[model samples]
Target: MQPFPSQPLDHDSLHEECGVFGVIGVPEAANFVALGLHALQHRGQEAGGIVAYDPERGFNGAHRFGYVRDNFTKASLMETLPGALAIGHVRYSTAGSKAPVIRDVQPFFGELAMGGCAIAHNGNITNAAALRRELIERGSIFASGSDTECIIHLMARSIQTSIPERMKDALRRVEGAFSVIAMTRTKLIGVRDPLGVRPLVLGTLHDGAHVLASETCALDIIGAEFLREIEPGEMVVISGGEVASVRPFAPAQSRFCIFEHVYFSRPDSIIGGRSVYETRRQIGVELAREAPVEADMVCPVPDSGTPAAIGYSQESGIPYAMGIIRNQYMGRTFIEPTEQIRDMGVRLKLNVNRALVKGKRVVLVDDSVVRGTTSRKIKDMIIAAGAAEVHFRIASPPTAWPCFYGVDTPHRDKLLAAQMSPEEMRDWIGVDSLSFISLDGLYRAVGEAQGRDGACPQYCDACFSGDYPIPPSDQIANGGFDPEGPTTLSDHTAP
Candidate 1:
């Protein structure tokens, strides 16, 4: 048992997605995984778990509720997880219960006929409900509410004789986005689903140990050299310091999530060989070209909005100032959990730079406006701080639909863009003007020269375009679930 961190203050932003990390052929592998997960803490703050295997100890696991730093950093706990092969997961519960529980924490372990195998997964399983029902009827007992447990149960029921073979069999029967890292007594494995909706990469340490993580930033923290991205539909297994590749799923078009480049990933990380920071900065450039506005100064919402704001300032030749200052020390602020207190989060987390924006026409740049609640509050704060005008420039296209693959999002009706046009949103938020980068412009910024291909999109822009590359099986199975109802896949199934 462990202490659960304070619940994050509710705000208009996408929930943090999960992150996975693994290492093989290294001493104190769990320690390395801890550092990697620390770098990925931004992706998930709810809970974390790690599983390691040693010759004598076999499989040792630790599951805790809260940030990796608060739990995994303790030497007393890390000592018990001694092994040369380890894998870990940081979770935000897109596919499980919202309330914190050790059972829902991941790097789920199972004792197979071949050996004890552990798996850590990033991304959601769309078909988890049906799979879980079938498994339960077949007498499989579930230990956690996470959809990731479906894969473990499938592996357990596989007819294959080897762990990797069993994993292949299990994944073949599954559908939806996944980038998985798994471990056996002698091997470390990584696999990305055919569409590649989530990011995963391979890295190598100086001592020749291989690392697999959801993002390159995790690799950076462990001083691992990124070898390459694990390709879509490809599975790589590392044993005895050697890596082998196999394609377990049929080849399909790649649809990596474009949101990773927009807001989910750390700007310092790389995706598809392009720098995420550079892409966001380029997004600002595109936004400027599409919606040039006359303003005294351009300001960012701060933190996530900084890079794009810099690019906007550079492209438009407008003097950029710190119009809004963020309180960097603030972590979770829902200790009171009052509705009024929740509404005060924007003020507590951010403050307008009164001296900088006293009477200036300030253009406020932010990644995206989800519910418009936070944006409205920010605009009011700027107005109260004496800003003459407030314009909002969103770096990504308007989020019109909820994401089904890993990202935690509200239902269709709750989304601001889904209900109102940009002009209406501007009026509702009381901003002087509001604009979001065009879908094609976002594609161009991310290196798609001519723009997004309508028939075969280069990336998954489902949240923006409402074009899901993979059919959400369970949602469809739910008889095209009511738009007004709770929308998360987990909400429709048993936890």
Candidate 2:
């Protein structure tokens, strides 16, 4: 077995997966959709796609494996694309499937008895193996090894009377987090999984056009006024320029992943009607009220850690400084193709501002630390940069178990905090002091849990407290990444 933390977190407290944008309005819809997708490019830079529907041409899927700007141009889109309704997807593969290779591009296209179904998915499903087996047994063929493919197959096999009915029924059978945008011959539809583990928002343009996206930022770029989010466990169908919902698949509940506000969604966006930036600021205020620390300067780890650090500094009456500088051009360290490159990625990814950190007792505010390896290296770098003493504060709780839904976290041993005591973890990370935000305090930081109903609450705290909102596969099996298989162009090395 590989050495790994039993569980890891999926949300980094910054940068979310791909965004989906669709327009069901006018003839220029394809062009407007492309422009909206450009706004969502940050969610996934590795790939971009837009599938436009034309009655004369059926459904056309255009994909490129690169940044949106580089892959598409107004001229190319104008020349090759034409339609009144189009759906687009940007991608960040949680699995190693994501790559610069053209074959790895998304808006996965497939033709079924029900007509053309182009699916763009965000988040992972834990029960995918079981569902895949069920489909394979029923004689459905699959093209890719992605969990997203499982959904296409399921939708094809459902005995529902209509395509939309079959799609919703297919979703009912799958378990885990998912928010998907599916484009059909004459419709653009959005579906969020039962728990609403992922987010999907709806909007409309001035010309009576309906738009759907993962975040409001995408809508903003395309000038679509915000509508409402596709309700959790609900399906919104847009056909013939009309929008309506399928029955709520699961009981309406707010199991929205809390991590989104802390790290994933951009601060400028509003999630579930609340400002993420303001939420993070409130978190900082709460963290200060609950766990105050004295230090010469409060410095965040950079990017995700910045806003919270500002809040902490402001509430604690300490000065806030930009103690760390990120190498903005550094590609994903996890995506580095070689170990040597991965090591260099860490060094080049973040550089401490010696002038800000040196000779000062610094308070380090980081979103969360995964396997202790990265934090240890970060600590060494800061010390080398000449900080007098470094104290670490995790804005979230420790991750002790792997997440089965969407996050690639597998196994428990890789987590530094799994079996070790706080002091042991602190020593392991080589920090002067360490403390994670308390679990209760963490919920209070979000402040949306207004009730405690039977069983569970509105949020998913499984990764932190070992209480899964849903059950994992109980089959007695032990296997993972087939190391002998032909390697694809990806980065699936140690996390």
Candidate 3:
């Protein structure tokens, strides 16, 4: 089996599958869902959809191929989805075709034996291809090519009397990471995979409405009080402003994705009760301690790299400077579909501060480097702006393996770290020096005092360590991937 086709262009950064938001027992719940989706727009920007249920209107939904603010915020659209219970999804295609299809936009609804239910998911289903083949052989007619639709079809086949029960039966057969938010006429349900590989949080509104979202940032958008994260393998069914919890899977240790703290999550959000921003800064602290370099200034790649740069500067006793500035108004997808424009990609989004970086030995701190194309471009920009030397300090471990748990990573061959040594990468990118935080150092940053527990890792560092918590079943069956043969990150990779 070959690697998945590369994205349309080099989007240097990785993307999580989507973001989900659901609310029950709130007036104009669709409006609240829209607000939550707006806050979660960072997680996904390809498309958005909302499903709402009202006593008089039954179930109504609007799926559009664009941002939530561009689609779901319209008064006409929000009015059509009038209800006290609603669920929404902002999407970036990981399972289906990369091209945006309205049919593939989620908050997917299915009319079951008992009632109708809508589901929005934020993780990849590793065994989806196998599940789809089986379901097709068994006479299941599918609408969208999305792996998420497999869950719906599976639910349709379950011989259960209740929607929640059917969902449980269906999820029991699902493999890979999934944090699901589903809504029925009166009940809203949330569930996380056995490993908790993705995040799902529970919150409560002032009016006692219950909310389930992919991140705490979404909860904050609606002024909801953070309650707690839904436990791995746990399911919560909310109806009449009350939540009922259930554990349908066998007990297992939590292995939430470590990369959430690195790049996927918003800095202001919280994960495992730890502040994400603080953790990222601590990652920078660790990087400074582990890969110290004598430099005149510590400059962040901007936005994602800000906290880490601050930590590095503080630790190394170097002055912090905004050597590079990002265009907040420029969207990541601003490039035209032309080679000339693609060559000018990073320039459109970022620029070096000529005066600040001129004649300075700059240390560039960034979250992670995927293809290395952007890193090379940034380094050239710095040098052309008159920087004497440019060193790179990455906040996370090398992303050598492609993530199968929701994140849209490039194929292994496309990953710079996967194809070359750190020294080789340093030369290839034309940087003075390059270093990535060790896996253990990253664990320490996230509050693991002694570093990653190899015997039973507290977090899923599959992309960095290649130790996948859940086997990528479909890829394995198709041939090429080997879970047991992961390339271990050695301390030497950091020079």
| lDDT (0 to 1) per candidate | 0.87, 0.72, 0.88
lDDT of 1: 0.87
Q: Write the per-residue lDDT of candidate 2 for residues 1-495, one digit (tens) a residue.
A: 223422212222223557777888678577887787788776776678888878887777788776777666758655576778778888766543434455445677777776888788877766788888888988988777677888888877777766678788777787778889888777788998877878899998765678888888888887788989888778898876688887647475557777777776778788878888877876776677777777899988877788788888889998999888887866442355665664453566788888778888888888777676667767888899888888887787787756655554535655666768889888877899988877766676677454223255557665676555654542212343222322111121100
Looking at candidate 2, the ten consecutive residues that score lowest on lDDT are: 486-495
| TM-score, one value per model | 0.94, 0.87, 0.95
Off by over 4 Å in 2: 1-17, 95-104, 333-342, 449-455, 474-495
Error of 2 at 360 (Å): 0.8
The best candidate in terms of lDDT: 3
Candidate 3 error regions (>4 Å):
1-10, 95-98, 335-339, 487-495
For model 3, the local distance difference test gives: 0.88
* Model 1, span 1-495: residue lDDT tens: 111112333536797668999999998999999999999988998888999999998899999987788899999999999989999999886533466778888899999999899998999888999999999999999988889999999999899999999999999888889999999999999999998889999999966699999899999998999999999999999998899999998778888999999999999999999999999999999889999999999898888998899889999999989989888867752365676775566777899889889899999999998888888889999999999999999998889888878998877767889888999899988999999999999999999999999867888888997777776889888876533343332221111
Best by TM-score: 3
Clash number by candidate, in order: 0, 15, 0
Q: Candidate 3, after superposition: displacement of residue 247 in Å?
A: 0.1
Measured with C-alpha atoms, the lDDT of residue 466 in candidate 3 is 80
Report the C-alpha lDDT of model 3 over 10-97, residue by residue, as the tens digit.
Answer: 3677888799999999889999999999999999988999999999989999998877878877798788998899999998875335
